[model samples]
Target: MSNNFKGGRGRRKERGPRTNDQIRIPECRLMSDEEQYGVVSIDKAREIAEELGVDLIEIAPTAKPPVVKLMDYGKFKYEQQKKAAEAKKKQAKVQLKEIQLRPNIEAHDLETKLKKAYKFLENGDKVKFVMQFRGREMAYKDMGKEKFESILAGVCEEASAAIESPIKMMGNRIITIVAPVKKK
Candidate 1:
């Protein structure tokens, strides 16, 4: 989380408005007296907008029936900004954190690894669990697989299951990736 809302002096310049992503709201239409058809006259629409002390913003121009609004453009813009801010607040930025282990790890060491994994998962981060295999240890891959299985069970609630399972290799390492669950 960053101090993006910390507006004050000595701030960096923004890249102008992002109107390209604006969500267009519904607006009222105005037409002249002679061309009003089934709609209210332009004078009446203008008077309504003026009474509300808001802009008579023309929203649609190239339609068979053009649209307009008797609303404060500034207020509409502010509401749009508030909605965008609320959406941004709900999004999480997941970071990748790696933990290394060995097949011959002791119970205490495994506990430490599990604790670290839990911390990373609770902090909106993805965890990469790696179990290294030495020369002769490759023959005992079942131990590494068991270790991976146990650890996955330990943090299953904290993290969602990754698409692929751990990849084991000859005299190398067993690697698995897990993504954190969204915080309630």
Candidate 2:
């Protein structure tokens, strides 16, 4: 028998600033919110941070002399998380909405599906049109393609939609993806 499981230690951990007692460099370039302290011994920097009731955080450990800063580590982390949250809130998530149809769909049903696809595009959701062929219906691939193209053209003309993926066959189904055009 062979064991294929790997230990969790093989995974890489996120790197963060070394704060307070975790900073072990003997000397480093120190900076504070008010001014820069040039190059100074770690003990001197720690003394200044301790006098100001702030933590000594190593910001650039890869620098020639290492760069440390005197700041409230908790406050710094909070501000970083707040910025990240703000960015995430401003980002838009595009969802994919799939609409299934058949090659022999009636004109009225096709119109309804097109209307639904337009609504999806207006709401900033991508649309995927899929038509599956059954048995003998697969022989008329050109008809399926024509139907898919006609529906897509109608939807694109009605709404400001652009094709993200062209019509392609997946197994027994023909599918295409469309997305809303970005406003300048």
The candidate scoring highest on lDDT is 2
At residue 92, candidate 1 shows an lDDT of 74
- TM-score, structure 2 vs. true: 0.84
Error of 1 at 33 (Å): 23
TM-score of each: 0.58, 0.84
Model 1 weakest 10-residue run by lDDT: 16-25
Q: Each model's C-alpha lDDT? A: 0.66, 0.89
Question: Which residue pairs clash in candidate 2?
Answer: none
Locate the minimum summed-lDDT window of 10 residues in model 2.
5-14
Encode model 2's per-residue lDDT on 10-83: one tens digit a residue.
65454677788777888999999999999999999989998999998888899989999889989989988999
Task: Give the true-structure RMSD of model 1.
Answer: 10.2
Instruction: Supply the global lDDT for candidate 2.
Output: 0.89
